[model samples]
Target: MSETSKVVLVTGATGGIGSAVCLRLANSGYSLILAARDISKLQAACAALDRPGLPSHRWISVDMSSDASIASFSHELATDGTVLDGVVLMPPQMRPTGDCQPPADMWRQLFQSNFIGPLELLKSAISTMRPDPSQGRGAKIVIISAITSVQALGNYATSNVLRCAWLAQAKTLAFAMGERGIHVNTLSLGGTLTPDYVASIDLRATKAGVTFSERLAEETLNIPLRKYGRPEEVALAVEVLLSPFSDHMTGVNLLHDGGFTRAY
Candidate 1:
């Protein structure tokens, strides 16, 4: 299939990494279905892309924290019947972590957005993808997960647990959909210079009575590469995972950390 005819769905489309991934895919000629919670941010993202002459890629409001919103988004996609060639699932960032455990209600909300909602959308999306040789190239699914999915982080207990669950979910989907020609995989990221990562460092800087840059530099020392990754750098990996280049790879977590994670 031609690039312009292919459709890709991206959740959390307004975020730092997510937006970069969208831009990369747009430049590669894929029609995008941008999904996120805030309508204004979504509009701003679409405007920044500026695809004036060609078919305008769409933006749909989606609250991963709410089942109704996810269902609505899925219903719209199913109704449109746009043959999805790629699906990128980037769950919304979680609240800052602390030493104390959060309330049970908070955990439920976190799981709903980080785990359940995306899974539901995946189910709907699979139905709209090319399933076999007769239907053209197979569809690809990329779930953006954190490095904590493999490693344990005491501070980010909720994320550590939920992201691990998502990894398993992606692997299961990979097997379930492999015969149908859908590639399901997860991209595990380490520290990137995204707004969320920067804000987290800034908070630590404030509490430690140090400059944000200094804190950021100190944090980078833990990474073997001695720097936080740029959003575009991570987006490149997303491109690879979604492209035909990764046709042989599936049911795996491709780590994009700058060597911060030591585990193999």
Candidate 2:
């Protein structure tokens, strides 16, 4: 199958990393289905990816935290007979501060957004993804997670737990779905200088009585690369995973952490 004929659904499509992935895939000739909670932002994201002569992209409003919303979205995809060639699952990046041990409700919320909802969507998407005999592989599923999954982050206890669960689930699915030709993998990222991360740096700087540049430097001190990742760089990684380059890879958690994770 040609890249132009492939359809990729990117959840959280309007976010920094998500938007970058969408643009990269679009430029590589893949049709995109941009999914997010906000209709206006989804429209804007879709519009931004629109090229003059390329295949037009589509958008859908989906809140990954809501079970009803996920069910509805899944039904819509099935009913519409949407054949997905790839799915990029970018769950909500919720960094809840304050308790090291959060409440049960907090854990539930985190699990739903980070694990349960994405799992359901992947199940639904897998049904729509038929392996192309000509290509000898089925669809690709890329779960976007944080480096905190492998390394703990202060005040992000819930994320620390759930992201690990997400990675385990991806590995399990990769094994379970290998026979079906569906490649399941994950991208665990480090401090990427997205708008969100920049704002976070600004807040940390204020609290620490330092400038943004100083705080940013402190954040990258432990990383061997001594720099945070760029959204465009992440997009390129997503593209490679989705392309034929990853046909032999599965059940792998590829870390884009700039050498932040030292454990073997």
Candidate 3:
């Protein structure tokens, strides 16, 4: 990558939404550092994003749930001397508890994976970022959250708590980092048809003794758009937030929910 090219580190880079974001950013001329737990998947994602004329992209293995892994990754990031420009943080993988009162151990695990670990990683990422307003160089941080963060989902108790924590943290960081020319924002998503989500809908359909299309139609009834979002649509929204178009935006929680979020 050229010295002047912007470098963004995208966590969960191999997931549906993450890979789409990588492609969008790469096409827009940003070099990427793809971070994920699986090396093979990371390699595949990096290869998919690489093209003849685009800036090179690389991958690193880091388990966001492990403190040791996060520390090691942070050390490597700080010493690599890469002028980190931005970060797109995808929520950690989690299973639905299906009840509000989960075990204490589950609470602890979710907190570490969703709240504490991401906070530590962001601290390290911010340390490596060099933002200068006068030079037209600034940093962006986009935290990808779920609609559970904004509304209550009976089966996603842990996510409801943790994602709300993420929103608060993003808002706090926006105030804390704004003076340093870093824009921190959150994107709350709803019912995106990712592979995992599709599987979830399939499970629901089987449980309800209905066809997939029937279950899916029921799922979209509450959404004003009457459809789930596409991963590429998410990528477009992320591109705007990470670009100069959102230079003046910070502490903003943008909802990409097909108008499913009814809160004022």
* CA-lDDT, candidates in order: 0.84, 0.87, 0.89
TM-score pick, better of 2 and 3: 3
Clashes within 3 Å, all models in order: 0, 0, 0
Stretches of candidate 2 off by over 4 Å are 1-4, 96-98, 133-135
- Per-residue lDDT of model 2, residues 1-264, tens digit only: 344478999998899999899999998889989998999999888888888778888987888888999999999999987889899999888876758878889888888887888788878888999876356856899999888778888877777888888878888899988888899999999889899988988999999999999988898899999999999999999999998888989998899989989889
Model 2: which ten-residue window has the lowest total lDDT? 130-139
Candidate 3's displacement at residue 107, Å, is: 1.0
- lDDT, residue 154, candidate 2: 83
- Candidate with maximal TM-score: 3
Q: Which tens-of-lDDT digit does each residue in 22-107 have in candidate 3?
A: 99999999999999899999988888888887799988788878999999999888787877899999867667778788889978
Tens digits of per-residue lDDT for model 1 on 131-187?
Answer: 574655678999999898899876787888888899888888889878778898899
Q: Flag clash pairs in model 2.
A: none
TM-score per candidate: 0.92, 0.94, 0.96
The TM-score, computed over Cα atoms with residue i paired to residue i, of candidate 3 is 0.96
The predictions' CA RMSDs to the true structure, in order, are 2.1, 1.9, 1.3
Candidate number that wins on TM-score, 1 or 3 = 3
Error of 1 at 175 (Å): 1.0
Q: Rank candidates, TM-score, best first.
A: 3, 2, 1
Which one wins on lDDT? 3
